[model samples]
Target: MKKMYLSVVFLLCGAVLHGQQTPSGKVFRAGAATSNITPKIGTSNNGGMQDITIRSIHDETLARGIVLDDGQTRLAIVVSDLCMISREVLDEAKRRASEVTKIPAANMMMSATHTHSGGTACPVFQSEPDKDYGKFLSARIADAVIRANHNLAPARIGWGVGSEPTQVFNRRWKMKPGTPIINPFGKEDRVKMNPGIGNPNLLEPAGPVDPGLPVVSVQTPAGRPIALLANYSLHYVGGNGPGEVSADYYGMFANRMQQMLGAEGQDPAFVTVMSNGTSGNINNIDFGGKAPDAVLPYEKMRAVANVVAAEAFKVYQNIKYQDWISLSSAQKEISLGVRKPAADELVRAKDIISKAKKPIMTSMEEVYAQETMAMKDYPDQVPLILQAFRIGDLAITAIPCEVFVEIGLDIKQRSPFKPTFSISLANGYNGYLPTPEHHKLGGYETWRAKSSYLEVDASTKITASLFELLDKLEAANH
Candidate 1:
């Protein structure tokens, strides 16, 4: 009886030891030539389109599979610098990666920075492409996956949040009493006299700004930082011109972080990746229209990018490293139906199309037109992905779409996990996921814009699904 009891003790000890083992992670910089790509005209800035070259560029975050105490699943995260990752492309990438690495398709979460100035717009959405830009991007992104798999190493992880108020501003300005503005139809209109003018009235004076800059620092057991992933929601619009193909503020921010950390020798084979949060209605420019005397320029964008990066470095210094952890990830697809164009709206669209002047427009304009037509035809069928991965105290909720700030706040408010980072524009960019109320306002985001194809209710439904997934993951963890 004594011998049997000793053997049982040994077995239990081994199980505990196995459960506490740290999972490995890897970081790799998949550099590609993305310069010479022009900004999609008519969407944002049309400043005399120049041939812009990429400076500091976008990156991919590839975390290896980590099995948590549950011992039944694994998780991976990939961050890229593109306008948005489409479902088709994401599905293909996952399928390919799984074939190569045996990492299940559902176990991985991929997101883009939503940088307007990056390579050609994704072909899945944009009907036309600038030369071979799409092909180049697809190949380069795949390379990132392969490289990350090669660089896997045993590392400790730490997470923390910090804030920088001056770097980002709420672009949606509330119209003050007596403020004058032109209507979308070119008629002069008086600014509403109500307090709701210019403000995002539904929540409060302003929506919850994720000043909580979530940072994940990976380091070797020797305490050297190897890579850092930081997430924020402010839209990337530092440099706005046709010729410039930069990573906007994201690139500059990453470079600044590297420089700051390098000074302390804390920078590990470092790559600072800026994952964009839900920023569908966010922009740096608050165009009060009259071409104000002082406009924020591209150079100002670079400066702000550096400032944001500096703020991230401040948070990085405070992270406490931990090694004993397990990892598990789950992803589910929720179906989102498209908004059909109203009967009267279809007639109006037909009239507008008949009167449109340009016979030859750029690919960007064509995409915009196509999305509008899609709204009039079949309701778009889109897949909403809710993916979650837990690494000790750090849990990442990957949501699809350009999520609004409110949604992210809502997730954080109810999340059972501490430091649960919500990443938007992940796996696929179906379009702007606006709250149900925003849909009623009938603004650009809520409308059938060229880039987005879904209705406003889609955002709310998707957010609810995400929260559900988080709740389940948290329960499983316990």
Candidate 2:
């Protein structure tokens, strides 16, 4: 009887020591991992009106993820280096990851970094995705989550906010009256996108910029950094060499964060993720300001990365890491009307394409003409996935579109959680999400194309759904 009792006690101790629990009654753990997602040379790259064939690689792209388990609940957040990812691809990734880690498919939040030079993963304008590359990307994203789950250990988590206002500028401008602002559809517009730098015709920016840089840091019990996920509202800094594949500034920011935090040479390498925020109408250029001097191929992006990373490092110094934090996720699919072209517009599109001289579309009119025909076959309504995750007092919302800065600002202002930030281009890629007011202003982002075909009220509906999820999360926490 004495021997049997001793054996039972030993078994119980072993169970607790083998990652089932920490010394404390509740175990809050986190793990982070990265999966290389760099596409092969000669693969298609998106982010321009025309597709680019990759000729050289400037840097490796990655899908960096972090898994957090708070005794009862588990949540995974992943950020990938790509222009945009489709719903089907992300859904498959979530399914594969769930099968391995037993984390509910809804509990994982995955988003693209919106790097213009990264591998093409979704069709935008004339750029089409490479089907094989999409499949490979899905598998790698799932692998990232599985690996992170396997590495879970007792960890600390905290969040802080930083601001770098100098880098972000609203790219849409209200041109002087009678300035020829013809859109692809040959309609006049009040605002123009990327209107020349220091052009006297420029009046002012049509929208405001969001300069918030929110950082979420995870670390081991011994204070070794596990991962740091940062969100910024600046669109990609695009100065890469022609036909060169890169993760753009997103990957650069990750590397800089790792170096600045002194997280080099650890047993498990430190992973840093820079997720795109609401930057659909934001860019690094100042349209109304003086044009910057000519820069080397990757110089501009590196400069932007350093500046943003420096701001993040400042916020990192003041983070208050907590040993235990509640984690919860809620997901919902909402259907919104698609702004398909009307009968007259479709006819005009077909006419334009039929009369085009070049075999491939080279003019703006030809590109948008092709887009109009594609939109004609789209369903009247399409479902979109909206997700919200709660990490202690911090809230992170994910939307499957290139969101506008105003929407993000409104969410932060109204969210029940303090210092809330959103990840755009998440789970799927729809198109640019401009507000109804902006839509009325008739800018490039509002033109009817696959790249901007969301209904006028899509932003309103999305925010309503997100608030519902966020409110539920907050109530449950209290």
TM, every model: 0.76, 0.96
Q: Please provide, for model 1 over 1-478, each residue's C-alpha lDDT reduced to its tens digit, 9 standing for 90 to 100.
A: 9999999778765544343332332221111111122334322211112223333332321222121122334445666666665666667767776677566878777777776666543443333344344444444454445445444444566788888755454544445445454433223433221233234432222233556688877665566556677888786764455344556677667667767877334322455678887666665543322232444546766777777777787888888877646566767888878776667656655555555564532443343444455566554675577787776667788877777777887777778788777888887767677687655544445546535567657767776777777777778779
Model 1 residue runs over 4 Å out of place are 1-74, 123-127, 130-132, 176-208, 263-268, 285-298, 360-371, 378-380
**Top candidate (TM-score):** 2
In model 1, the number of clashes is 12
Q: Find the 10 residues in a row with the least total lDDT in model 1.
A: 27-36
Per-residue C-alpha lDDT of model 2 across residues 1-478, encoded as one tens digit per residue: 9999999878766654354763446768888999999998988988688878899898898999999999889999999999889999999999999999999999999999988988988888877888999899999999999999988887889989999999999999998888888888988889999888879999999999999999999988788899999999988998999989888899889889888888877768898989999999999998877888999998999999999999999999999999888889888999999998889998888999998986679889999999999998899999999999999989999999989999999999999999899999999988999999999999888888887898999999999999999999988998
Best by lDDT: 2
